[model samples]
Target: MTFTFTVLIYMGEMWKGGPDTVGTLHKLTIKAEPGSVVTCRSAVTIWCEGTMNAEICVLHKEESQKTWGTQTPEMPENKAKFSIPSVTQEHGGQYHCYCYSSAGWSERSDTLEIVVTGIYYKKPHLTALPSPVISPGGNITLKCISWVGYDKLILTKEDQKFLSSMNSQYIHSIRQYQAYFFIASMTQDHIGTFQCYGYYNDTPQLWSVPSDHLKIYISGLSKKPSLLTHQGHILDPGKSLTLQCCSDINYDRFLLYKVGEDNLTEHGNQQTKTGFSLSNFTLDSVSSSTGGQYRCYGAYNLSSEWSASSDPLDILIAGQLPFSPSLSMKPNSTVHSGDNVTLLCQSTNKVDTFILSKEGAAQQPQQLKSKFQVWDFQAEFSMSAVTTALSGTYRCYGSWDSSLYLLTQASDPVELTVSGEVTLHDYKTLHSTAPHLENQDHTLENLIRMGMAVMILIVIGILIFEGWWSQRQDKKSTSHRVPEHGK
Candidate 1:
């Protein structure tokens, strides 16, 4: 005579349980181990403790959404461990755990925010504007460049998400593919390790791998950095030179600028910091385009104020090339069609190379090594089967390198006139312009005579054809007379 009682189930805050029931939701604790940052496409486990015999649910808070909802977990049990097999951009958000059992639903656990990063796509390149160092009370810009067309770009400091819209005072769009985040009136708090990520519109949840981390530091400098070049003030063209930016105080970064150019055109790179930071700007090959007055600045890091401009150093490129080559053609006065012409370039001083450039020619200049002669050096440029197109003003120069800016002064230009087969229209015009002068030039006279002879022969051939056609017509008429005898 045993009796059993059944209780009606309701979705409420509390529930009555028997001996078979396990612990309630209030006794459970959910947590993420090893911090919240998670790499994309990796596995992460969320552990829930003390909620035995209960249905567990995970809730995610998205950046764009304010509400939280139920999410499925890989494993759901007491001390449940939920695994995210492949984390993506969408997986980056705040997460919480909830449990429901006979004792009713439990409150959500503390939120864990996760961030996913990867190298699966083209990442945005991060660069600092107006130099990485910012004055203590000045402004600076961080530029995010993505050429592969990304819908969104994000910047992070110390692995924490940074919203450009919220953190930056001004946002500038450099181009369709570039964005700049401007921070004004920077303080020591603004300095940190920074990285950038890019995201496509179709896969907004997925983020590109973090860019190289840029560490910014604060510096107090009253003097500018010293600018020094390896090769004195005068640099030889076609030679490599390095401009070093040095400072007396310890710095993490250095910047170099062409004195008169726009500040936006300044150049800077990550440099090693010893007792003092030393950054070197190398011109692999110097030319006239690279010669200018340069100044440098030093700073602790991106957030540090820049030192005052260093003493300006003038860089001049001087060539040691010999005198310009003298240009002369095989046939100086006239070049005829299908004729091979050789243009000889001679230099009184020994030259290493010769370059022949033609005026108004889109073609590249012809280059040749100079041949040692008894007292000078010479080079020959041959134009085979020359045409009117080859007739132009040509000049030559002697130099060791191929760069135009590094070569010796150009030689005097030589004019060439090519003669080709003259057309009938040209001949008529020539005759009309100068009838008596034709006999003086035998070539023109011969062409005119040939033209007249061809015209006479054509007329004679036409007359003969007309006579033969008339005879043929008469023969046909006579043959078709319907038999003259019967008529």
Candidate 2:
């Protein structure tokens, strides 16, 4: 007679050959090939490894009631490979495996989640709260928003597992669903590109299309690169702009970051005559959107770490407002030293403020609040005790409170000349005649002083000669008288 033994295990309880051998065996390990996150319609293999003498391996989806059992004879490597020829949303879930051996049934393996992406058509939008350039030990929030009302949103850093998930909150102000993931006490490890997805709770492993990549940068990493432009920061509309990012270090690339922007513009480095590695970022037909605070960073091709940010550069856009202002100077454009001069900026259109800019001046443009005058809105800029240092071509621009960085067309250029105790308007005529007349008068005065000096020296020499002659005659007379007295 042929006798057979059967074992049944359920909920950590096992019945081997008999009730005496009812102990749990070693645990099996389960993993996914390539990655746990797979695209829809792609092939993937789930691997379950167990002891060498394992007889049968069973794979079970935690969310479903069905189970897949395979005999160890099919896979000679003491493992079970379950291949999915064409993956679908149904294949996405958490899975575990168990192996049965001669001793007993093995413990259940750790859960491995399989995520199938591109299952939904709508994609989400990812943005950084406050800014993406964060300092170490600072906190940042990543906001994932979508028009489709997903149950939850998942945030994932590149090459990392799902970092966090949050239930979607409907924002009535924006009419969109969004989830905020807060990361506290940021460090260098948190600096990387990230993406987000939307998913429903019923099928946690199925996800929508990923949002666009957003990069998080850590500030104060290394030496900063320099950001500059050949043209001044103030620009007119429709003008082409090119900003240069340069660094003394041999960086392989450069990134231009605009404040309050979600994305960074990157460019490859090139050799330049300034002996620094540099990159040029160009914007064609610049508009008001191009104006903002900008900075740049240097990075290497092999590393994800970026250098410290460059100094902030503010770009101002002109010719945005409909009307321009008129600039005029009181007491004429030419003024003497210690004279108070007033520059009036007048606009017919209602203006909230006025900005006075001097051509080629290193200081920031001067701003003043506008007041309603008899005929128009105007602002007066007063200069007390003006000097030659203030001499330059000046222009004024009108702006509204709504757009601080945008300005009206520049006013007609006005030239201001501070003569500094001299009348600069007639400077050419005075320069041509005054020097020659002053030289002639100086030569005559010098000649008269030299003649008086010679006359005084001649009088002093005559007085000394007369005293010497008188003394010699007295000595001779005394010698003759002394000889007579002795006789």
Candidate 3:
């Protein structure tokens, strides 16, 4: 005997069951094993999970009408596994699955997109709009561009957790096809390396080669690190420069970022004698392109968050302009303390400003507006009551207002010598005289004593002469009187 089973229709599918309402079956879920993104010729599995009493499952591709079915016991009793031995470009697309049981066919699962990479040879170019360094609650835009005219672009993060796609737009100005992905309110989770891929609309899952990696760094997450350079910020072309990034938080890594630059220079942290963590970045034979505002950040190895940015350091490239300035000190380079001094920086060419820099100074160079003098453009920096602290080797540079970071060649260095205070003793000793007033007083006292001795000797001589004359006269009278008495 032969038995016939009546089939009922629901949601455009034939199933063997009693009369039941459509769209009332339990929903099923579908997911890709490993990941939805697969490399060429790699193995992958599509899982469909539902009720344990499910007898059969059907997997359907959204792009095509192809359907795959799995019987019970071949997979687990509760789920169905549709395995692909070697995935190719044709196997990549949107997919859904349905499971059939006593309750009838389950609702179609949500769509899952399977991407196949490394299908094309040309790769897209990815870049950040302003820079990769971002602060918390900030926004950044990532641009993906290509010449191949792909219709779609996909951006993927390093951890495989973030995936986004956008339709490409033709940019006639740049003659390229591009797409912009804007990330808003950046947080610690947004800090990571990223890459992009390009694909056509017809083959959404088939992608070209991946673009070069672009790293995104989030700042203001921890304490900032200090940036320092032993070499002065103003440097001649072809000079070697080394910048140090230091922090006291024991960070494991350091990142050096130049403003208006897309790439960051990274280095491992080294412990210093003061128990501070630091990293040194060196640039050999630097040219004009090396000059810019720079900042540094510190980060730990295990965490993606970076510390706050260090203070900006502006690097000026010298000898890029046409003319240099001359530096001179008024009233001789050597001056006494408390004397007002003036440093004159003069340039033959018309300059918008003058920069005066002292050697080994940690502060920024002093800038002054240039004034048209009798013969040239000059700026005078007058220092009143100059002290020894102000004495140092100074050089001047000329720069235009438009290009403040680019400067002319350095002028000849002028040395300033500030002598100590000059006392009255010092003035007398310099003229080869007695250093003290007491010696002059002693000489005047000796002259007065000699004059008094001379006066005393003359009075004694006059008295002796008077006494001798008186005695002679008296003896003569006595002699005359005695002779008369005898007659």
lDDT of all predictions: 0.64, 0.82, 0.82
Report each candidate's C-alpha RMSD, comma-separated, in the order given: 24.7, 10.8, 13.9
How much lDDT does candidate 2 score?
0.82
Q: Write the per-residue lDDT of candidate 3 for residues 1-487, one digit (tens) a residue.
A: 1111222133234333321332447777788988888888889899888655776677777645435555442445487889998988888888877766777667778888899998987899899977898888899999999988888999999778888999999989989999999999998888888999999887888999899889998876699999998888888888999999999899999999998777899999999899999999998787988888999999999977788899999888889997789999998899876678899999989899898999988877888999998889999988776666667999999899888889998999999988886433334333343355546544545655887888898899889988998999999999989978999
Check candidate 3 and list the clashing pairs: none
Global fold similarity of model 3 (TM-score): 0.67
lDDT score for candidate 1 against the true structure: 0.64
Candidates 1 and 3 compared: the better one by lDDT is: 3
Q: Evaluate candidate 2 by giving its C-alpha RMSD to the native, one decimal.
A: 10.8
Ranking by TM-score: 2, 3, 1
Clashing pairs in 1: 89-205, 90-205, 118-209
- Candidate 2 segments exceeding 4 Å error: 1-23, 68-77, 248-252, 271-274, 299-305, 336-340, 360-364, 369-377, 382-392, 418-487
Worst 10 residues of 2 by lDDT: 1-10
